[model samples]
Target: MFGFILRRLLSGVVLLFVISTLAYMLLYVGGGNIARRILGQQATAETVAQKTTELGLDRPLLVQYIDWLSHAVTGDFGTSWFTGEMVSSGITSRLGVTLSIVIGATVITAIVAVIIGVWAAVRGGWVDKVVQGVSILGFAIPGFLIALGLVTLFALNLKWFKPTGYVPLTESATGWLATVTLPIIALAIGGIAGVAQQVRGSVVDALQRDYVRTLRSRGLSFNRVVFKHVLRNAGGPALAVLAVQFVGLLGGAVIVERIFAIPGLGQVAVTATSQGDIPMVMGLVVAIAAMVVIINLLIDLLQGWLNPKVRLA
Candidate 1:
């Protein structure tokens, strides 16, 4: 198990390195007149040139990347080009807000998806049809639309949650939950739709397997046969699907965060990309890529634990 985890971590590091390198190269090459944009149109050509040199934009791209990577490995991502805020500090301040929403949504998606999926698979009648219909609708509706609908119903009409703004968990737990609940729901609907279908399919397949029949024939209770044996075999695929949904939730949080006015990496990412703030943009890219790598590694470990055959693979 230790060796399996070590291999997964090493692979994750490689993936992170590749993703960061590609993002850096693309941003550096495509970012046009970053200094001029920062300095404004009124700045003279000579002034812009001086600003560019000061930022080491005059350096070779390879040298610039090496410099950034050297400092990045030490947790020094440099200051934002426009705001002059430390990239690490800025990200640290906002990371929690985004993570809270995405993580909450993922947990809800997994639990609800499993219950609905298992129920549908076991019942196999109107219950299955309803689950399928809801999953389809969930896929058809956009996450932003869901956010708007949730905001209108819960925040505007019902007054259950605030329409916009965030409250830190450290400040008030109830306030924080109120602020994030709608966004989490909006993000989760789509994920639940997708994962529930996967779970339903996997569970149905497990039910049809010869092992399930054998277990029933051995006089095992129905609940025990289904929960202990069937779910164990079916879970591997559903977990894979859930891990993918978690990553999708991270991207979906961008639109949901905007709709709800929660301060998070979504805001930072949009602002930095538009302004050509390389330091901030690169910081975000690396941070998000690292998160994806870590999440994938954890999923791999979990899958290995659930099925020892995965470790061999």
Candidate 2:
């Protein structure tokens, strides 16, 4: 296990390097005449030259990339050229808001998906029919639509919860809860639908196995047999989907974050791009890409751990 974890960590570092390099290059291409724009076309030659040197836009691309990579490795994410704040600090400070929404949604997704999914699978009559219809409805409705509808129904029409905008966790816990509640519901709606569908399929297949027949023939109680013997094994496949959905949300659903106006990584990335804050945008892109690679590597490890055949092989 230690060796496996070590390998995953090493892979993560390689992925981070590749991601950062790619982001740097892409930003360079996208940021047309950046120094000129920042300093203005009407600015004096001296001003343009000085700003260019300061931004290292005058340096060779290779040299600039190396400098950026070195600073990233050293945890000195450097100052945002646009915002003039330390990149690491900027990202860190706003991370909590993202965390609250992601964590909340993940917990809800798991609880709701597993309970509803397994039930629908094991009891495949009206339970299956109802679950199918609901899950399809969930998949059909996009998150932004759901979020808007929720805001309209709950906030505007019903006046149950307030519309979106973050409230800090430290001062007003209840307010924070109210603010995130809508976004979480928005994010979770699709995930639950997908997980339930996957679980239903996986569980149905698991129940048809020869071992399940043996258990039934042996006179074990239906509940005990399904929950104890079948569900755990069936969970392996379903868990993979759940892990992915968790990562995607936790890393920040950019669209949903924007719609709800949650000040998370996604929102920052958007703002940085719109303002052409290259350093900040590159930092956020690297962070998000690294997050995805790390999560995928973890899912690989988890899959191996749970499946005995894979472990034995």
Candidate 3:
């Protein structure tokens, strides 16, 4: 298991390096005059040349990449061209706001998924049908549409919550939660439905396994057999999907961020792309790619632990 985990970690590091190198080359070597664009067209050629030298745009590609990588390793994520503020510090400052929403939404979605999944599996009949219908709807409906509908219903029509903007959770936890509540729900709906559908399918399959039948024959209660044994065994595949979903959700916050006007990494990424703030955009891209690779590695290690066959492989 330790060997398997170590191997996955190594692979994750390699993947992150590859992603970062590609981003660097595209932004710097691919005809993107980083400093020139940042300085705007109105700036004189002399000023542009000086600014490029200051920003080290004149440095060789290899030197620039090495410097960028070294700085990234040491936690210096460069400054935002638009705001002229340290990018790393800006991200750190907004970390609380983004994390609150992501973590809260993730937890709520997972809990809801588990409950609905287990209930649907155990109950079957009409309950299962309803769950299936909802999951289908979740898969079909776009997130932006959900956000718009939520704003119209709760904010415009009923006045139950604020329609736009974010409030710091530290300042007022209740207000922060209330303000971001709809966004969280909007984000969570698809996750909950997806997880529930996967869990229900896994549970159904696990319940009919030979080992499960044997456990039942051994006088184990139905609930014990299903909850303890089946849930854990089925978790192997279900967890893999869930991990992917979690990572995807963290990066895919762009749509949700835009609709809700939440200033997060996703929002920063979008703005950076629009203005061609290559460094900021590249930083976010690296962050996202690293996050995804790390999550996948963790999932592999978890699967290896849960299923010994995976460890051997």
Candidate 4:
């Protein structure tokens, strides 16, 4: 297990490096005349040249990449070209807001998906059809649409929540919950729809296994047999699917954040991309990539631990 975890960690590090390098190169090569963008459209060629040299854009690409990587390794992501603020500090300040929404959505997704999925599998009637319809709806409608509808219905018409705002948890737990409630629902609904389908399929297959019949014949109650044995075995795959969905939720937060006007990494990402902030963009990319790799590694280890066949093999 230790060896497996070690290997996964090393592989994740390598993947993050590759991701960061590619992102950096793409932004460096394709972001197009950063000095001109920084200096505005009216700047002369001489000013642009001077600005480029000052910003080290005249340096060899490899040298620039190395310097950026070295700085990143020490947690100095460098100052933003446009804002003149440390990129690391900028991200740190907003990290909590993003994490709050994503984490809350993940927990909600897990609970709702399991309950609905397990019930749909065990019952196998209209419940199954309902679950299928939900999955289709979730896949058909984009997340932005969902966010818009939610804001219109709950925030605008119903006046149950604010249309757009963020309150720090440090300020007031109630205010924070109120602010995140709609966004959390917006993120969780689609995630739940997808993961619930996976769980339903896994549970259905688990119910067909021979041991399930054996357990039933041994006078075990239906709930006990399903929960203690079947769900445990089925959960490994479902858990993996859920983990992947969590990553998707992070990406979708970009759109949701915009719709709701919540200040988060998503807003920063959009602004940085529009302004051609290479260092800021690279920092966001590397940070997101690292999170994905780490989450996947944790899921792999969890599956291995749950299924001895996986770890032993």
Which numbered prediction scores highest in lDDT against the true structure? 1
lDDT of 2 by residue, 1-313 (tens): 6666677788888888887888789889778878787767799888888998888898889999998888887778788877689998888887777777777887788789888998898888998999999999998887778888888999889888877678898879898888989888888988899888888898899899999989999999988988887777777888789878877676446777887777887778778887788888877777666667766676767766767554344
Residue-by-residue lDDT tens digits, candidate 1, 1-313: 8889888888888887898899999998898888899999999999999999999999999999999999998999999999999999999999999999999999999999999999999999999999999999998899999999999999999999999999999999999999999999999999999999998999999999999889899999989998998888889999899888988998998888889999999999888988999999889988888888888888888888789999999
* TM-score per model over all chains: 0.98, 0.91, 0.91, 0.97
Model 4, runs deviating above 4 Å = none
Question: Root-mean-square deviation of each candidate, in angstroms?
Answer: 0.8, 2.2, 2.2, 1.1
Q: Which model, 1 or 2, shows the larger TM-score?
A: 1
Please give the range of 10 consecutive residues that has the lowest summed lDDT in model 1: 297-306
TM-score of predicted structure 3:
0.91
lDDT of 1: 0.92
Comparing 1 and 4 by lDDT, which wins? 1
lDDT of 1 at 53: 98
Candidate 2, residue 247: Cα displacement in angstroms equals 4.2
Candidate that would win on TM-score = 1
In model 3, which range of ten residues has the least summed lDDT? 27-36
lDDT string, candidate 4, 160-215, tens digits: 99999999988998988889999999999999998899989999999999999999
